[model samples]
Target: MSYRELIFTVPAEIAEPLGDALLELGALSVTVEDAAAGGYDENPLYGEPGLSPEVQAWDRSAVTALFNPEIDHSGEANFIPELLASLKESDFHLAQPSEKIVEEQDWVRLTQSQFAPIQIGKRIWVVPSWHEKPTDPNAICLAVDPGLAFGTGSHPTTHLCLLWLEQNGDLENKSLLDYGCGSGILAIAAAKLGCNPVVGTDIDPQAMVAARSNAEINHTLIQFILPNEDAPELAADTKYDIVMANILANPLQVLAPALVNKMRVGGRIVLSGVLARQADEVIATYSQWLKLSVWQESEGWVCLHGELLSAISNEQSNPSHIESIATPQKKRLKLVLLSLFFLVLLVFAEHLSRNSLLPTLATRIDGTSSPIAVSAFSLLQKTDEILCRSLRCINRSVSDFTAWKINSASLAQESSGEPLKIPANQSKLQVEIQNRLAIPVLFPYLELTLTDAEESEIKTIQFSPQEWLPISWQDSHPLFLLRGAPSGESIHSELAFVMPQNTAGYRVRIFYSH
Candidate 1:
């Protein structure tokens, strides 16, 4: 319902008591803000790691109290006089009060009205669940909803980060790490844009839960984890192609070392959730490990992008030295080294492809002439055909083959199983696979071992997406990708595998590589 709002500018010492007195005088709710906000006299209060909580309130307070309009027919004319007289008798003086009518609103609709499809760059859009997907066929729309976490793409900080992501171009086949991943927006966007193996870490379990839920909604695969004291040790073991952190300045400054250590040399780091005035302090904090500069600014928020500097020394150095090392010659040298590294990987993959060890072993298996073995071989051949067609290339000739492999480990390692529907008369068992991994797997072949009631091995057969596609009637895009298992982001294609009717149970083992 509509209400009246009474506002008073009071000294910090009197603000709390005045608010309490208003509540006792029938105010529904009372809140305080800095009277000088957004002005030359503004005072911004920030809480640091070791600071006491008592210092949180503003120095000069604008106390606002909400009251039912019917309580005082004359508005402030009656209530303000009564309130001032009571305070004075108590030896507490309050300045002149102001009143305004607050119109009643449909709060739910009002909140929803404040959010709409937010476009980032030319290719990406953040869409709320209630809205229709963007009509732009090329637009990468992320279905996000407001949740308990921090991000909704409405905040200026989030906007800045998303803009950076869009301007950076295709993240396809790259690994990304999202630190302080509230709502998992950035990580999900990266996954949609083709970044393989996106990892999102947050200190709040609620945020982690929200992030995972958002990823699932977007049909993107992202690994969300809670980072604790031992996070540094785990972070040191892995390196990312890009690292993004959209958190406040203090935490960002404190995390500089850890974030830098987790990035590959020359890899890019994107940071946001910082005010324009606080940019210099954050830049100075990270300058030790990365050469940082303001990349973009929007609505008073700034995004900083930087490249990890060479790891030539353990001690901290000046920003000038970091800048010096990021010169064109050094960048070229780094690029050359990276190219050679990938070249070695390609050669290694080629060797594996040429060996054809798995096929040879399958062909030589005992009882290959038997019907079960023959059927298994047929399934394997069919899977190979589907992979070649859908993945575009089965051999190392495809550059993405190596990238797929590198990005595979980034997918969620957890596996879940469920029974697939089948005819009651058929002596075959069908199982469905939920490939939670971030990168697509090529020709995911599963080996199933049939067992009798006595739990003794009876017969074995293999099944893959090709065999499951016709039986399961699933979409062909994800299963038949010539590139391998398509990235299981929004829709994880369930590949059905058929097994010889099991009198008892069976064991499953999946085999595939990028």
Candidate 2:
């Protein structure tokens, strides 16, 4: 089947009336675009949320209407002239009307051909209903088809987000909240990865329906609901372990506070649907409550990942100090005196028992620490274990450790066509680091590994501050002398790897020892 497409360049004032006039004159479909597209006078029209209806169309509009080729006007033996006469009589004049023959094709097959099984990271695959599941038996296949919703894993923004989730492991037992969950792909992926109690919210009722259907097909338990303006609650009195929002930059900025309030302390967030240039703006918006940075980039799109920071995390890291401040003055003094007396008694007992009871008492004190303190101490203790397991280094005491925190960290591949040329045997890896702590500490050493989609380590590289650094401080100090970076500082560093073939992603483990 074929059709005739009638195109007209009309002023914005009459575009709507002209479109209605065309439709009343027996047009199949009408579409509009900017007449000055690709020219200096081009006007870009954006339909942002809360935008007025007047701003939806361009100043100079090009309207195209489709019609069946079989339509005839044999009264005068000419169809174009007769149609023009009719439109002019109806007070809708198209000065110059253009006609073109539009060939028709199998739109269903064509649309289906445009989509295939998209592989995200190693374990996750977004497969359309018509497509076969990936051959990998262990793959977490999501049965999603194109619908009225937005995401289908073909867009670079969604791809970047899926890759982030796959590379960041151990989501088991975590809770997730997916805002603007078009098609609910991210929320379902989290559920498949072992995150329980997953919830997806969207403003569109159709999107909520589609997400629910998709979740049912995937056999993942996900709760899909419309955004409740009155009570926007996830779990009552509970914060989410992971929150994902793959929305545009403006909405992301507007929802920053709401999203932050839903996240537990130290919980992770993944944001996409942002351009590489807009990544900084988005990060700055979320920087107040969440430390966000670009985690990955595909083509020109960027994915930002961050963790929630609050007074709870700070208190958890230093329970004893917090307890001192929170406790009454008299109780604090009594505790100090009791601690001193216990120290004296332990010293005497150690002298008498010849160190037999010293180890037991130390173990008891360590075990009696608060859960947050214990977790922090365990992470600190793992420094020696990590070094011993992978790279060899001297074990140091935790007391020497500075309070420097990893407010934002990102691991991404260098863009192609970088000015710096890499050797034939090496590949480029870029690391973005931000310090959110009040005081700066020495440059922390990092251990980076290039891994394939399957997460198998292909190559391991240990980096210190002395290595090839991109940003330099005015008063740079030696690596051994723990450099002091002022609060809210960022650094970028690049390193060349031994060019591991088939490398899909990277895993970075930072080892900070002062």
- Winning candidate number (lDDT): 2
Q: On residues 189-294, what C-alpha lDDT tens digit does candidate 1 reach at each position?
A: 8888888988899889999889989999999988888877455424677898899999888788888888888888778899998889889989999876767899
Task: Give the runs in model 2 whose Cα sits over 4 Å from its true position.
Answer: 35-44, 51-53, 71-77, 229-236, 311-514
lDDT of 1 at 98: 49
Backbone clashes per model, in order? 14, 2
lDDT tens string, model 2, 355-377?
23222222112122346544543
lDDT of 1 at 300: 89
- CA error at residue 505 for candidate 1, angstroms: 81
Residue 474 lDDT in candidate 2: 33
TM-score of 1: 0.54
Give the alpha-carbon lDDT of every model.
Answer: 0.67, 0.69
TM-score of 2: 0.57
